[model samples]
Target: MNTTKRPIVTGIDGSGEALDAVRWAGRAARLRDVPLEIVHALDFPALLAGGVVPPPEEMKDTLRAHGQRYLRAAQEIAEAQGTTAVTTRLDPDRAAQALIEASRTAALVVVGSGGRGRLTGLLAGSVASAVGAHAACDVVVVRGDSWDDPEVADRPVVAGIDGSEPSARILAAAVAEARARKTRLVVVHASADEPRPETEPHLDPQAATEAGEQLLGELTGEHEAGGITVERVVVRGHPRRELIERSATAQLVVLGDRGRGGFPGLLLGSTGQALLHNAACPVYLVRTVS
Candidate 1:
């Protein structure tokens, strides 16, 4: 067992989507040989005020029981996978806030796309988006029935790179995952500039490829030193569009929150936010701490 101090935290709300999140979290925890914490956040006041009027004591007991049920379900999945699993019931008034707080001690925080509410499928789900934007650790937003795809067990781990310092960490993490899974790692870099008018020369394709290859070489060399196999690719278009398109067939896509831009050292970047909302596969964001 890895015996890491922090466990992976998964959000559960008794919804089918949350159950799927639990399943994914269990598999991830087992693969990493780390502990798993199943979390259920409750907004008791909202629940009571939203039609179902229950006494304060009754509401407390009801929420507790519901949380226990969700936890038991998660525990069952973890037990079957032979992984350590724990549960936490939090009533922080706001679901996203509670989940983000829980993420402080989590290796990764997992959440479902949509839940049993009216705001389901509203672009990555509110809770998932919230945590993805603010969590200190990685966040995964699971969506779609394709979660059962067998390719998930054998697919390559894809990561986006732009020759940024934070990309070093992202590339390292991708290599670790690929090595652990005994799978291939794909490093993609998207570079696109506005096309010039008239007979103007193009941005030398050969030059672009060489530059991309050089960056890929550096990233691959670092991973190869650690015995990780990786393939490098360069695409021309919008970073978000290209990455999302590539993610359609990837098992996982790893990205850094910020890159070597003006404020390259920031925790969050525009390209990352775009990918988080649009990527098809589960997205992982690696933060570069200052």
Candidate 2:
């Protein structure tokens, strides 16, 4: 598949949060001049409690109607977000599975922080986590009140790096995002307890902090292009905790899928579950290694 031809896909479950994802994805697609795809999933597996293949025709029609309604509303929201080319789909597969499959040809996959309706797991947090873990492309779990906060519009875009995963791609994405938002970029390398590398037997706390700061500067210096202000932050705290705290004042938070520090592995494992659930803004995740 051609990377430039891929669409930005978002899955909705008739929830307000899912609509929020649509709004975000729509703006993103417009910015990149790509198509925005809005999807609604009818999770029929849960409806098979009666031990039947599809339950019944009436039930299937009702589910389809609901899905169509949600997709219609999502389409309106995306269009209002200034997305010129918009498309929609009603998938019969499970929410996680459908989104994961769609991700195969998508540039990005998006989902809400949660859902409230029965059979509307498309917006559920678990579904978001699943997609984040297994999606073929980068994932963004739409969370927090950053969208509704008036002051958050000017917040910087944050990128968390542990120096474990490949920082180049993560830094590049953060720079692009900050440039698009016309905001500053904050590159953070946090250490919970000023921990040192296991291979180094004599490294002290001060040395560790120095090392982290040096790494942060060296990794981000090359990415300080596009006239966007870039700031380096090396704080003493858990990476996840620091990142989540910083997220409160950020428009977007970017992280690698796997690493050490507080970011041992987000989406890949439960290491970053707290950060995902409590992020104050949209969390954009990218796999460090393809």
Candidate 3:
């Protein structure tokens, strides 16, 4: 197939959460049979009095040294995870900006749910959220307490589908991830009843459910042919809430950067943001190239 060599890149700041991202990225790299790159951004803003002055050489050296240490630790973690093809980069730029640039040629870019400084937060770090929204390729934000556990590989890979334009890409990525981990695939579609016009005929709930089931089957048919176990769940409710609740026991939750219900003008959709912020597991955002 398309054999473009793109590495799995992960950002680290030496925090336990960052290291968790590195660990997850390492496993993903190994599963994809690709190289892994661990990056640490040295983002130090300076205050100046009407003039800009670069930091002293000693200060810059100290930051670089600390970054090197973090990279080394991350490298060790990746190696320990059996990912031998690993590299490290020390970026002198904002974490989100650096990661976004890296995503240009990366198969996937990963970051911890929260990190130090501007990267620290509740559901996801600021850098992680920004990168996830803007990255050219897929972005995975590692979350939950068990994110660092390699044993969680057995959990099913969950994907949210809306039968939208990006549904195929989302399903493909989810199926690939499930195949990589040798886990089952859980496909969920949240069907919310929309109000029809007064002159329009009422739609049957059973027909809608049947249509959803057929769509899921058609989308995952190729993967099923390859012996992938696929389960379809079509429920009536809000898509974001349903997906968030499903994330509780999932190894990873995959979704499009924007869905059919998303605002056309927004770069990232509300459903994606909700799942990113509240999902109990790592959330993978797949964006199809325009």
Candidate 4:
């Protein structure tokens, strides 16, 4: 299916944070003019654990009822985002694995930053980590940490690029999001060790900066020329540290699946996992054909 038509799917485990994710997913669905799917996983395995005899069938009904109740609540939030095309699912699977399955046909999979397993009892913090690590399409781990702060509502959408070819996709996606939010795009390129070709014994700092600037300029020209304002930054520091700081004021942080600036790995690397857990705003992990 065309990505534009694919639903924006979010997993809800009845946690407040999961509700927050539903809100975020609803807005994204409205933005993309697509459907919103709120899924609740009926994790019997989790509930079944530490129990000897099988629970009564009535208990099963209670769990299903709880799942439906959570789904109803999530639907309300999504609808409030002005999305009329909203759907809900009650899946019988583990939380993380269920969302990952939904992601196969979803345009985007959204989850809350952290939550203790409560009513549904499927857990989200760890689920967020797992889904963020394995989702097939783009993934958004919505962090309630700073997204609700009025201070960050107008901040730019910051993107971390490892200065690789795929990094441009991150730039493009970031610009598109920034444009949608009527904000600027901050393209950040930072590394603990300044990226230098092994063949070059001595890399000129000035030349490196100039090259970084040129590459960023070339990459951003299309987006900037289209009227999306951008700020390109290159720093000689740990990409994770720089991005985590910027995430404090960013509307969203965009990174690639194979994103690694100079670090051994980015989102798939050390920076990827760090930012996922630490970024103040939502972290978008892009990994699709586009």
Candidate 5:
């Protein structure tokens, strides 16, 4: 029933990481010139014992108070970052479900890698993983040391390319982000093998490099008119390893949710998950909605 217009929505749970996510989302909203919605979802199942019966009035009030505190803190953080267009919501649902619903009307959904939860040992908590895999729009998981370092903003935005349609979609999103940040875009393509013999075996290594250059140009030609600096890179190595290393010095790493090599029914590809777990910057997953 929440028919709010598209905005940048971030999930916060009052933890340091969640607040970090809030700060990142706030800056992103400012860059995009859109409103920021800070959301805190009350754990409905944790509140009740067995049935769907509502808790006592006192308990309900306590939960409401806690949610409000988190919302206020997040709102203050966003405001301090100069994101004046900010709103707060306290949804009585699970964190992942609340964020999933918000994604339906959100230009982007941001969340911390981990937050207040029982599974603290995981690199990414259940809520983060669920939303990352299922959000309707692009999802950003705020993690790694570079995410909190102010100097990282000066770095370029890195885009992983595999010549797939999904990769093209992610490249478009990455270009927009780089343009908004007034930073350069690094387009990287990594492959472990030579050009497939069945496809383009006639092309030598130098020619293959030229092909990569041409492909990058074609993929980003439209955006070049916008004055965005782009660097084209072609590396012969494992795509996942190469991308993870490239992400170490980048401001943000963008990748398609699934690439050509992804399993038939997988929502998130293996390479995407590897980067999500190991990237040294915030990872943006751009999924094509079917």
Candidate 6:
């Protein structure tokens, strides 16, 4: 009934990871003074293909009844947070498509990784990864096992910046979050090892370091509003490894899927994908759209 707009939308499937996403989304909405929109996409094709389909209408009260349960659960989460919330159901052939569409207008979109229908060894759920890769806004993918941790609290918000426009966006968002939460903001620029002797035309080490510093200055200058403190670091190593290693002590680690001079649709490179699998905490990917 609440038609008001919120800043975040999280996909719910009653999974533990989805629940963690709900909790984090609640915290984010609270911090930003915005409502949370919880969405549950009912992919009829997926359900049918997975052999999880319900009985025919002759035996069912209504098709929407199934969707109502997820919506009701999402509403309960909002009530627990003491904020307004909206629940919407999308009937798409694919769950990922529905989530991507919903994220187009949201400030943040959240989804869970590895669910009932997931394949083994898949670090991220296909739908969640797809949404994270292509969404117009920020996307959060919650780890299922970490949801039960009782001590989960807002720690320093960390972001990876490396002289790229997308990295700039990540840095700005991290600063805003740090300011709002009164927490430290850590900006890390992680570089991979120099290409092996076998590889040709690798990145120059000196140039990379210089570029990193200039990128840091650009971001720092833009956020020099007074009062909020910022921390910057330049580490030489693989980006995803460094980010995940740093995330061991951070509450939220923000990174961009696409780097400078890269196409926007690619969420994370091989390095980012590696980190997403092993990160101890929640990892957020801010998608950059041209």
Q: Pick the candidate with the highest TM-score.
A: 3
Report model 5's TM-score to 2 decimal places: 0.90
Off by over 4 Å in 1: 2-4, 45-55, 118-121, 193-204, 259-268
Stretches of candidate 2 off by over 4 Å are 1-4, 49-52, 117-124, 193-202, 261-271
lDDT by residue for model 1 over 199-289, one digit each (tens)? 7555677787788888888768857656656788887766678788887878778888665552633546777677766777777777665
Alpha-carbon runs more than 4 Å astray in model 4: 1-4, 47-55, 118-124, 191-202, 261-267, 288-290
lDDT of 3 at 38: 92
Give one digit per residue, the lDDT tens place, for model 3 in 1-290.
Answer: 12357999999998888988998898888788888989999875532224477777788899999999999989999999889789899988878999999999998999988888643246567887898789999999888887556677778999999988889989999989898888999999877733445885665788778888888888988778776799989987788999889888899999999877565567787888887789889999998544
| C-alpha TM-scores of all predictions | 0.85, 0.89, 0.91, 0.87, 0.90, 0.82
Query: TM-score of model 3 relative to the true fold?
Result: 0.91
Model 5: lowest-lDDT 10 consecutive positions: 191-200
lDDT of 1: 0.74
Q: Pick the candidate with the highest lDDT.
A: 3
Model 4 clash count equals 5
lDDT, candidate 5, 1-290, per-residue tens: 12354799998887888998999999988888788999999877676767667678788788889999999989999988878789999898999999999998899999998888737457777787888889999999988865667687789999988887676788899999999989999999875532354765566667767777787878878877787898888876777898899888999999888776665678787777888778888999997655
Candidate 3 — what's its lDDT?
0.85
Clashing pairs in 3: none
lDDT of 6 by residue, 102-191 (tens): 777888887776565788888877777777677788887775354335544546778887666566677777887778767778888875
Q: In candidate 2, what are the lDDT values of residues 233-271, reduced to their tens digit? A: 888778878888888888899987666643434446333
Clashes of each: 0, 1, 0, 5, 0, 2
List candidate 6 segments past 4 Å from native: 1-6, 47-55, 58-63, 88-93, 144-154, 193-211, 224-226, 261-267
Name the candidate, 1 or 4, with the larger lDDT value.
4
Q: Rank the candidates by lDDT, best first.
A: 3, 5, 2, 4, 1, 6
Q: Per-residue lDDT of 67-129 in model 4, one digit per residue for the tens?
A: 999999889988998888988999878898999999999988998877655335432378887
Judged by whole-model lDDT over C-alpha atoms, candidate 2 comes out at: 0.81
Clashing pairs in 6: 191-237, 257-267
